[model samples]
Target: MKARWIITAVSAALFFGGSLLTSLRDPWFQNLQRPDWLTFEFLIPFIWIFVWACATISAIIVWERSSKRSRPWYLMGIYAAIALLTSIYSPIVVEFRSLIGGLIVGGLATVLVYILAFLVKPISQKASWLFLPYALWGPIGTYLTWLLIQLNPGVS
Candidate 1:
């Protein structure tokens, strides 16, 4: 029970931390040309909250279901990796103004999410389902980053 609490707290912290680290109003971000079809900015926060919640639940499911196996740790490692990569993405794009860096990280995230899902399937199908939103969102994020790169040639 205590371990579950700890994991939940840690996951929440990572999600919130990653979210708080992103600032889309900065000058660099403000200067970038948004795609004409990019109308989802308003919904992004809500979508992320949903995705993060699902991810947390999925992690907990894995923790409980795979307690006897080594897969849990490896699975959690991938989660942490995705979190770290995601946390760095905004900083790379906004702080360093590197769209290419964002693209690289976002693409890797997309790939990792799929792998995470694949690995978790044997442990718990329900947990794998919970990751559906995140896995789906990954490509959207990667494509957004790619679009940013195409639209903002001035950014290095």
Candidate 2:
């Protein structure tokens, strides 16, 4: 009950912060060699808002669907891992200015998104479905990181 709500609130807050991990206005980011087709910078925050909203709702659904006899600590841990991984990605890339680091973190996050979706499916199909956007975004983000690495070689 109350605990579920608290967990949901915390998840939402953490993901909201994760959404803002990368700064579009940062000089380094602004100077990156982006592809001409990548023109949706302004939509990133909104896209993350939608993704995190889905993730939050999915977590709640999973929580409600779990049996009282067996608490959903595993799911909680997975969610926390994914959220934390997502949060640190931008900082790591920005601080080190390393496209390689970004690519690694992004790929890892994508894998975790798939793992989360797979784990959630058994608990609640609807909840798993809710993770679809995040799952899709994960690969897209990873691809973007890889592209950046390709565009800007020798980026330390």
Candidate 3:
């Protein structure tokens, strides 16, 4: 029980921290190109919430199935890998700002989340819930990335 709580808390913290760190790096964001509707100030908090929500839900599902030996770690690894990829590519792609590129990244992220859902059978139904929030954020992030690219067409 206590271990479950710890895992949940840690997972939430990782999601929140990763989001916060990314927002803080916005000033260093390389491209000026953005859709008129896509403002960093507004979008950052939204992304943070979406990311946190996804992590929270996923953690809860994991906690509920704590008895499973390999499932929790597998889920954690999947989410972490996806998060890490987002963090790494976000800055670079945003700096370069291209619609097609953003689309590809966004599509990949969505597919990965879906794959994660299928991979974890222990809490497939509940875990499937987490994927929606992740999916929602992927498109928003992709849009922002596309906007950045459009605004900075010359960014190489």
Q: Using lDDT as the measure, which candidate wins?
A: 1
Q: How close is candidate 3 to the true structure, as a TM-score?
A: 0.66
Clashes of each: 0, 0, 5
The TM-scores of all predictions, comma-separated, are 0.91, 0.90, 0.66
Ranking by lDDT: 1, 2, 3
Clashing pairs in 2: none
Off by over 4 Å in 2: 16-22
Tens-digit lDDT track for model 1 on 28-116? Answer: 78788889998878898788788878888888888887756464677888988877787777778887888899889989977988899
Predicted candidate 2 versus true structure: per-residue lDDT over 21-140, tens digit per residue? 665577997788987889996787788778877887888888888888997888888877877777777777886687788788778877887888998898899988998988888888
Worst 10 residues of 3 by lDDT: 90-99
Give me the candidate number with maximum TM-score. 1
Candidate 1 residue 84 C-alpha distance from true site, Å = 1.3
Q: What is the C-alpha lDDT of each candidate?
A: 0.82, 0.80, 0.61
RMSD of each: 1.7, 1.9, 4.0
